[model samples]
Target: MSQLRTILICDDEEELAHELGEFFEGNGWKVDVCVTGMAAIEKLRKGLAPHVLITDLRISDFDGAQVVSVARELPPEMRPLMTIIITGHVMDTARAVDFMCDYLYVKPIDPDVLLANIGEFLAHRTFPAAGRS
Candidate 1:
């Protein structure tokens, strides 16, 4: 059987992370969840290349924007990684406009809307290996 691409979700909310992780896994999307921004960075350093990153704006260790900037510094081959930032703040939404970030999900994350918007962004970045970033 073909393995599903891995997805990394960085959020401090324990319950939401677990629920989303289960949902994604059930849908054939391999997932890894990190409760802190530091852990997320470490996961990446350990070579956990994910197809998508579902993060929160208010992570304990680092902000979503910082995470995005750091991830961009990775080698080209490690690039196609997508990011979706979920926050309860409107300021976070406005700041996200500066980046080529794929998606921004505000608080009260509606599952239906998230999946739909995320799908649209991920589709474009899902290029084959040889295409690299």
Candidate 2:
């Protein structure tokens, strides 16, 4: 059988991260949850390439932009199919322009809406090979 699709969710809030992880898992996707941007970066650098990356803008250790930058620096084949930014703060143009993230969601996101978006992304993307990032 084919492997389940995977997602990486980075957020400083443990509850939110756990909630989102559980939500994704409930739908049959493999999920990795990180409570800090640095931790997420470490995972990515270690070559855990998930199909979708959903990160909070303001996170402990570093901001989401840095995490995205590191992910982009990986080999092209290892980059995530899409990057989703979820932030409670106002989005700055410079950071926004730099990342060119695929989706943006403000704070107080509805889990159902996020799940729908993930489903759409999964349907459209051709995922990369497993075990490389």
Candidate 3:
């Protein structure tokens, strides 16, 4: 059997985080939710390598950009296959370009659409095994 796909969600909005976690979990993703960017970073430091990362851009502490930056700095084997930033603010092109992430989504996201996009992204990519040259 294939390994289960894992996802980490970091959003200061507790209700939104939990709701997203539940939706992804119900759809067969192993989901981890963090209500703070610090907690998300700590989890990464502790070696919680996930296939996907979804973080809110304007977290009260640390911010999503910092969280994504930390994740990007990890060893290749520890980096997430995809990093997505979600924000409530309407971002202009220049502002959106400031963050390092695979996708930048606006808040009030449609869970189904997000899931479909993720599925499409995964389908077109191959994940190499750790330590492979």
Q: Evaluate all candidate structures by whole-model CA lDDT and list the values in order.
A: 0.73, 0.82, 0.88
Give the per-residue lDDT of model 2 (tens digit) for 36-91: 99899989888888888889888978888788888888877777877888888766
Q: Pick the candidate with the highest lDDT.
A: 3
Best by TM-score: 3
Task: State the weakest 10-residue window (summed lDDT) of model 2.
Answer: 91-100
What is every candidate's alpha-carbon RMSD to the true fold? 3.1, 2.5, 2.8
Predicted structure 3, TM vs. truth: 0.91
Superior by TM-score: candidate 2 or candidate 3: 3
* Candidate 2 local Cα displacement, residue 86, angstroms: 0.7
Candidate 3 residues 16-47, lDDT tens each?
Answer: 99999999999998899999999999998788
Order of quality (TM-score): 3, 2, 1
Model 3 spans > 4 angstroms off: 94-97, 128-133
Cα error, candidate 3, residue 52 (Å)? 0.4
Q: Which ten contiguous residues of candidate 1 have the minimum total lDDT?
A: 124-133
User: Taking the tens digit of each residue's C-alpha lDDT, what string does model 1 give over 72-106?
Assistant: 77776665367777887775337556654667767
Could you give the candidate ranking by lDDT, starting with the highest?
3, 2, 1
